[model samples]
Target: MTAMIKAHEIQGVIALENSFNRVGLDHVVLVKVATAGVVTRLMGGSREEVINALSNAWIDGQSLRTYRHAPNTGSRKSWAAGDATSRGVRLALIALKGEMGYPSALTARTWGFYDVLFRGNEFKFQRPYGSYVMENILFKISFPAEFHAQTAVECALQLHPRVKDRLEQIEKIEITTQESAIRIIDKKGPLYNPADRDHCIQYMTAIGLIFGELTAAHYEDSVAADPRIDVLRDKMTCIENPQYSRDYLDPSKRSISNAIQIFFKDGTSTERVEVEYPIGHRRRRKEGIPLLVKKFETNLARRFPAKQQKAVLDVFLDNRKLVGIPVNEFVDMFVI
Candidate 1:
């Protein structure tokens, strides 16, 4: 059902045609629009009501780009999607009560989403709303790092065994990645908070090399206080790979690639290791899904007794049982 919902969105009328970040808007605006349409229908609204709710979502959506990166990055990046979706539900509920929607919410000359937020550019679509995005959405199953830097972290982890014993002897660490990563996660200087640290490519790579793994715990102040992370970060350099950038934005390929190479003070260098795709890519679903399930079970086990955990895990593990259960009923099973 989640995949079904996402498919409906990515293939729907209003789709991600233009780059929201390039226009200074947060892409989560799409989430608000998409969620409004789905939630309105779920609440038994007619097609007209759903349209009204969706229009309102567009009219009300803010760019929220500041919360996504740099000096202003904070816990809000973690909650922005929830915020957008929640706002969508509220808008949909209001529209159900007869709140009107702007007929020209997207094209009203000076006051429309296109003119105001998109600089007069119309929304575009590559394909119809469908299950494709759901089938192909990237997941950060192997590391807690940002999706853009997932492969970089993997690349760094590969180089860890060689560099772990010679940290002080390393003179430089070069990381080459797609341009989107450089635009989104490349960071230097002091990171102010956990959100800031987790999103930094340099920070993620350094931690992966130093600790051999990156978990949520590694983003904490306690772990970050290890001076070696910043020391390594200072020695690291990040640049864009044109081929990677092209493949990342290509409609068909959509690969996220990163290569890490470390140079030692004694003029020795580690082999340059490149990871073209993170484990969670659709291309590697067979390899990724099991690990993703294990990750889910591990997190679930930390909260519940073994018997209860297995019971819950069993419900999820069985697709037939899981899909047949109502949403409310499934959620009730996790109630403390």
Candidate 2:
């Protein structure tokens, strides 16, 4: 979903619409990891990839900086498939060895990836880390959605209980998202479709308010028309939480939390509520971790009400889980 939504966002960027490039470097981050994968994989298992990996990474990187916040549009954003292994293919074609066509194709755009994509200005990398290849920790955890708004959705889930009753009375919804998020995810205008709908923090939060939750189903065109959703989105106003912004960037303390509060027409308000890190974040490892066993258990339980969830769980728990397990045996577990 991140890829699909990101592609849409890329379309917006190409169209020269609102650029997330200025404040939030979300675009370059994804593009680099995507195009540079093969080169990075080849450089070393433990050691970082060679400097030449920069070539592709640079193109992907500078593109983010080139048009951020400048309204734009294009079809690139709609590509459902991710990168096409540009690094390996490029290497295979050139077979060049000594100096690179350039170092850091992504993060550096000038005499680099930029000359290829953005025209000229040097692309700026947000931070230095091996994490760029895999993507930031926060980006990895999001099954599908922007990293900045993860906590925003998390906050909405928690606030649903309190505000569901007073949803109609909500004169306004005030949100505190990372300042970067305010600059990036905030949007207005016709939502062309679900891909567009999911990225709109206002729309995502409103779904959490009216439905008291969001699931894949909530984004469908049929469901998006719910009267309360548009009402809440239009009534909403969001501001950046400076500290939240700081915490969000701390690599060791990464978070995607959002704080939400609802105001009533009569001038009353509910408790201000917040979610710091989403359940999916790395910090929640000890508590929110979902073991393979639990996934197997829950899945089996759903498929066979009369069958045993414990039996399914035990198989996953076995220490030698996959070793020596025949392909047929592995496939059998999934069948009812």
lDDT of each: 0.86, 0.58
Task: Give model 1's TM-score versus the native structure.
Answer: 0.95
User: Which candidate number maximizes lDDT?
Assistant: 1
lDDT of 1 at 161: 93
Candidate 1: Cα lDDT at 44 = 90
lDDT of 1 at 265: 91
Question: TM-score for model 2?
Answer: 0.66
User: Could you estimate the TM-score for every candidate?
Assistant: 0.95, 0.66
For candidate 1, write residues 1-336 as lDDT tens digits. Answer: 864566255433354356888877887888788788788888899889988997898899485689778889899888888888789889989989998887899999999989998989998777776666766777779998889899999998888899899999999999999998998988989998899999899999999999999999999999999999999999989989999999887767779999999999999899999998899998888999999999898888888888878879888989899999988988877876
How far in Å is the alpha carbon of 53 misplaced in model 1? 0.4
Error of 1 at 141 (Å): 1.0
What is every candidate's alpha-carbon RMSD to the true fold? 1.9, 7.8
